[model samples]
Target: MAGLSTPKQKISALIITYNEMGYIEKCIDSVSFADEIIVVDSYSKDGTYEYLMNHPKVKVIQNPFENFTAQKSFTLKQASNDWILFLDADEVVSKALQMEIVETINNPNACEAYWFYRKFMFKNSTLNFSGWQTDKNHRLFRKSKAQFTDRKIVHETLEVDGKSCILKEKLTHYCYKNYEDYKGKMLRYGQLKAKEDFYKEKHFNYVLMLIKPLWKFFNHYILRLGILDGKKGVTICYLNALGVLERYRELKRLEKKNELAYYLVMP
Candidate 1:
């Protein structure tokens, strides 16, 4: 055990979970390299909390359901470790990533906060196409140095106060179990995004409704080589198109209301 580095600073793994019973155990089991693991559960009705109770290193915090940003910030505050590795219930740290975490801490002239390139797995295929492969997330950082941006809606990235490095390791994301789940989540996210647009006076525009979605599909499926993924590729593109259509339709209805309000005020 001579080479076994006990390490000086404590690294805590932080995860925010809801009904993640199915994936929680495996996700926590994979990141056991850390000194402590914190699970902030939103009072799930499933076996998630119970499982965490039985888990050796798992520390469960019961908080009522809140937005993602607030929940994560709250958990970060509870962290006893100097550095925190943020993980989702559905995300798993690969072996390479685990080593990267340890080495990054052991080495800071080397890192401020580390970013992970996610490989989104859809069904049996590791989707290299579909704008997803280009997506990178900040999954590791010092607790005091980074914070999740306070956005009411989804698609938020963690804002770090210092310089960062991109880890060469890939973090596997088991996001969206099946096509139905993917479709449902996309539609829900579209509605949330549309609402944000509505508040910002970003109501229906001819270009957005008609052009932007088509561009997204073409960019992902055609130009991005999603066609290589075949059926899954086509499905991902079509779903993007559909989500856009739904968002546009939602915005269009609000646009008409704005026009009507303007006319009423004029008279």
Candidate 2:
């Protein structure tokens, strides 16, 4: 007599993309183990949408871009399986991580969500320090037990309703292609942060604007020992500091615009 075999749980891999043609194929390939791959694209002009559409394994959906949380929330609804593996277009799953995910999901007592640490890559180099040393996120979770925090605009956060544990295997995150690419991403994040603050009615502080960036540079470059990474570290620290400055500047601009609008409609 033999014991009954338990069926392995299926997983739906979800990805969000915009102008990610260069990385989407590799990203998709890495998660081939999933039962299905769903991509929510934001009207990419770079043929990324076309590439996804033609892929037999991927189900592509086009949605208007709002915030990171909204875009991810839309993708979550398209999953057919209860177990979801959410990945960014710029990230790739390693073989070990893929195997670990399969094993974890198969267990009857597995946690509701799994956290994956990432190895950051910038310009083909692996970044060891500069505050990126502990980069991690919850990528695998039960769809029913997880939801995106609506208030988070840029750095979207997933709220899991049940237990969670961190996995040992790491995903590789190709963070930036070049200096310009990194700069553009930072600026976009800054603007999004400002928009989030504006909606929350948070006033801009000039003193913090001046102090924060300086502290950011010092924290990452000196306190975090980013100096060991050399020029790449310096560039990252500097750009991130500039992003902090830009966030406050954009917030101030939004405040002024709101004031002008209020004056125009005065009774």
lDDT of each: 0.81, 0.93
TM-score, model 2 to reference: 0.98
Q: Write the per-residue lDDT of candidate 2 for residues 80-102, one digit (tens) a residue.
A: 99999999999999999999999
**Collision pairs in model 1:** none
Clashes in predicted model 1 = 0
Displacement of residue 73 (Cα, Å) in model 2 is 0.7
Model 1, 214: alpha-carbon shift in Å?
Answer: 2.4
Tens digits of per-residue lDDT, candidate 1, 125-215, equal 5877777867888888887788878755456568888888899989988775778867876786677677768877775788778887898
Candidate 2 Cα lDDT to native: 0.93
Weakest 10 consecutive residues of candidate 2 by summed lDDT: 176-185
